[model samples]
Target: MKYKIVNINDTGVRSVLIIYTGGTFGMIQDASGSLAPFNFGKVVDRVPELRQLDIKLTVISFPKPIDSSNIGIQDWKDMSYIIEENYAQYDAFVILHGTDTMAYSASMLSYMLEGLNKPIIFTGAQMPIGSIRSDARENLIAALEIASAHNNGNPIISEVCVYFNYLLLRGSRSQKLRSSTFAAFESENYPVLAEAGIEIEFNYAALKPHDENAQLNVINNLDANVTILKIFPGITEHSVKSILSDPQIKGVVLESFGSGNTMNFDWFIDCLIKAIEGGKIILNVSQCIGGEVEQGRYETSKKLNEIGVLSGGDITTEAAVTKMMFLLGSVEDVNEVKKKLTYSLAGEMDMMEE
Candidate 1:
């Protein structure tokens, strides 16, 4: 895919590549007063403060920007490809994506790009950049600064992260919890990696360790034959059966009630058992925003453990789904996929205490 590059700041200590993926961050209104992707070539004109950052800025925008709602596996591949091709040239990357699916993209990239040693900060806005009160300028500026931040020649943030509002969260741990506010993302089960205020206060203890010797490996083969089945109070047997019985589905992210509890009804257990027997790797993740999936902590969830349903401890559904896709497509062995599903591949989940 061809990209249009726009140079913002030419001289600085560090260079940051701003990936302009279609989002509200680069939007403006037309004469008809409808929001659309603006000509990102003039991004410097919209957010002039970029000139003030001490980092050389270059933007690579998609030839035809798309809404985050339309982002799919191909988009993820494109983003990864861009990073892989430019890995050695740039010190950091700032991805301007729509907040709606920014968490998903970030989580997916965390798994796809292994052994990353530079910051890949994802940021977006709640309103168009054309709006007088839009948060786009602040978010972009902070993200760029955080991306270029380093100490003694080592990058401060060496993993995928989402910088929104004033919080910097691990990409895999973040979820878009709000729809209409600038504070649209949160990491309920993990600590904020950094906070932007008078200055960026980084939680060094929360940052993921990086291996400087390791090279970036981009895994592009993602299997999309995975789906989520959320259990509700009155979820029907038919619903369970239909979802589990899909022939094309290879993995299922079971969004179980608090702490992985599910109905103990014979039909429900039978459906789960049947799915497991059919060689479907089911990952049990909690539906709650802040809790974990304790597969056998209670009698309600004990059956899941007995049936070989894997526990996704404190993992967001977005991460669980993308992890499944990453494992299923990249790993040829189903047993290996099941093993990796329960472990933290890219610091996506907490390690279960044995």
Candidate 2:
């Protein structure tokens, strides 16, 4: 995929590549007064303050803008490819994406770009950039600043992150918790990596260590056959069976109740047992806001452990689902995949050894 550089200048300074994927931040109203995507070729025109920063800026926009809801595995691959191709050319990457699937994209990339040591910040706006009062300017400015931020001659934040509304959170650990509010994202089980106040205050203790030697290796083979099976009261056995019985499915993220508790019904346990025996990886993740999946924590969850369900400790559902896709495509052995599911590969989960 060929990408044109919009406003790149001398490499003597910190440079950030602004990846413009279609989102509200790039939308404007037409003569009919309906919101539509605006041409991002002049992105600096929309957010002129970008020119004031002590950094060189370049843009790579998608030929056809993609709304976040329509994002899929292919989009993830494309984004990775862009980063990999331009890894050495840019100091950082700031992806302008729709809020709907921003968390999912960020979570997926954390696993895909293993050993990445450069800042990759994803941000977008709740309202169009053309709106009388929009949050787009602040989000873009903060994200770009964080992307170019450095310390002691190395990048301060060297991992995948989502920067929105003044908070910087680990990509995989973040979740879009609200729909209508400015604070649309949250890292409930984990602390924010940094907060944008008078200046960007980075929590050095919370940053993930990087492998400088590994560079940017993008894993493109993501298995999309995984799904989340959230357990709710009176969820029919047939519904569970239909989900677990799919032969093509290699993994399932079971969104169990508080701390991985679920109905201890014999049929439910049997279905999970059958799936495990069939070589399907059943990942037990909590449905609660701030908790881990501790299989067998209570009587209801004990059967899950006995039946070979792997626990996902303090992992968000978004992380669990995307990580499952990454593992299912990468690992050939079911047992090895199960083991990796319980551990934190890219700081997706805060796993405590049992």
Worst 10 residues of 1 by lDDT: 345-354
What lDDT does the true structure give each of the candidates? 0.92, 0.88
Which regions of candidate 1 fall more than 4 Å away from where they truly are? 352-354
Distance from true position, residue 186, model 2, in Å?
0.4
TM-score of 1: 0.98
119 in model 2: Cα distance from truth in Å? Answer: 0.4
Q: Lowest summed lDDT over 10 consecutive residues: which window, candidate 2?
A: 3-12
The runs of at least 3 residues in candidate 2 whose Cα sits more than 4 Å from the true structure, single-residue gaps closed, are 2-4, 8-12, 352-354
**Top candidate (lDDT):** 1
lDDT of 1 at 321: 95
Clashing pairs in 1: none
The root-mean-square deviation over C-alpha atoms between each candidate and the true structure, in angstroms, is 1.2, 1.6
User: Can you write out model 1's per-residue Cα lDDT over 30-55, one digit (the tens) per residue?
Assistant: 98999878889789898888888899
